[model samples]
Target: MTVSAGSRTLEVKVLSAEGLTVDRKPVTKNVFVEIRAETLNCSTTSLGVADGARGSPSWNETLMVEIPPYARSITFDVKCKTSMGTKSVGIARIALSDFLGGIVPESSLQFLSYRLRNWEGRRNGIINFSVRVKSAMAPKYEPSVPVPMPALADRGSCGSQMRVPSGEQHNPRGVVTGIPVWWTNHSANP
Candidate 1:
């Protein structure tokens, strides 16, 4: 899928998760992580390693997702499937500043880890992942510089650009007229 306007493409690799537990028991199988960025739609990784030591699930899955313009974080929702149904194991909300902000380059790969929190807001585990920025956008607008209108000296020649001191108006030497000097980009208005 193409990155939409004002959005950035994030290549996120969900490597693995450690110390995950549901009810004081290590999770064994049917483990998956839903990767998303502040939206209902999400990209889910394949089931992690099925080893009995399910406490440490390994996914090693990479997903490309478009982050919205104002999104400053990504979420990893780890889930485990039980006989009853799917259950929330843990969730990690990772900030984008580590990889997207500051001096980080666009194509630089950043491997990082974050602590997960359970549905009840308890310390759960640590999710290891790597993220890279696929693309960057330039700022939309530059700071505007305000220019003052020069006071007209006479009707024939509206001349001289003078700096108006703070808290005081510009007083042309010798004499001053009420004629207003205007500068505009509108073509119709001269």
Candidate 2:
């Protein structure tokens, strides 16, 4: 499979969160934001935690992440730290297309707000953030060279081609324990 490259980077600023809850109880203080792309790469707030605020908390921090062209959305995991340990309040998935505003310019900031959903799929809170796409320079193109294909062995009525490596023995499973298997056959022939 060929992997395509992206042309821009996303700068995300996690502003704050409001009306958050954990297990039907209002969360007050020690709240932080965890932002992640659908691709699994993530970033967490590094500064002071939002503390002492019940239900509503403020962070006002910025996190920058590269946005691959194939990425469709980003997820935010909101949690609060307490004596009992950290508890997840809710998560928010924001589509890149919704805030990217079609064609991304050199540097454009977009303020957005989305509702947060708990693991049970219920509305739990709201998270505010700002996003922008940093334009990238066009890549220079070059001529490509095609690689030659390897030769294939002929198969008889058995419909299977076997290649035994030098100084290696094949187990009953047709695999050499310590050696790598470069070819495989789907035929029933032994």
Q: lDDT tens string, model 2, 51-151?
A: 45353677778887766655678889998887898878899988866866465453678788999999899999898888886554223333233333353
Top candidate on TM-score is 1
Residue 173 displacement (Å), model 1: 46
lDDT by residue (1-190, candidate 1, tens digit) is 7666567888989888888888998775688999889988799999998544454788889999888877878899999989899999999887777677557766889899989899899998888988898865432432233445554333334433333332213321112224444554333423
Model 2 vs. true fold: TM: 0.62
The regions of model 1 sitting more than 4 angstroms off are: 51-55, 146-190
**Candidate lDDT (C-alpha), each:** 0.75, 0.67
For candidate 1, list the clashing residue pairs, or say none.
none
Error of 2 at 153 (Å): 30
Using Cα atoms with residue i matched to residue i, what is each candidate's TM-score against the true structure? 0.70, 0.62
Candidate 2: clashing pairs of residues: 29-52
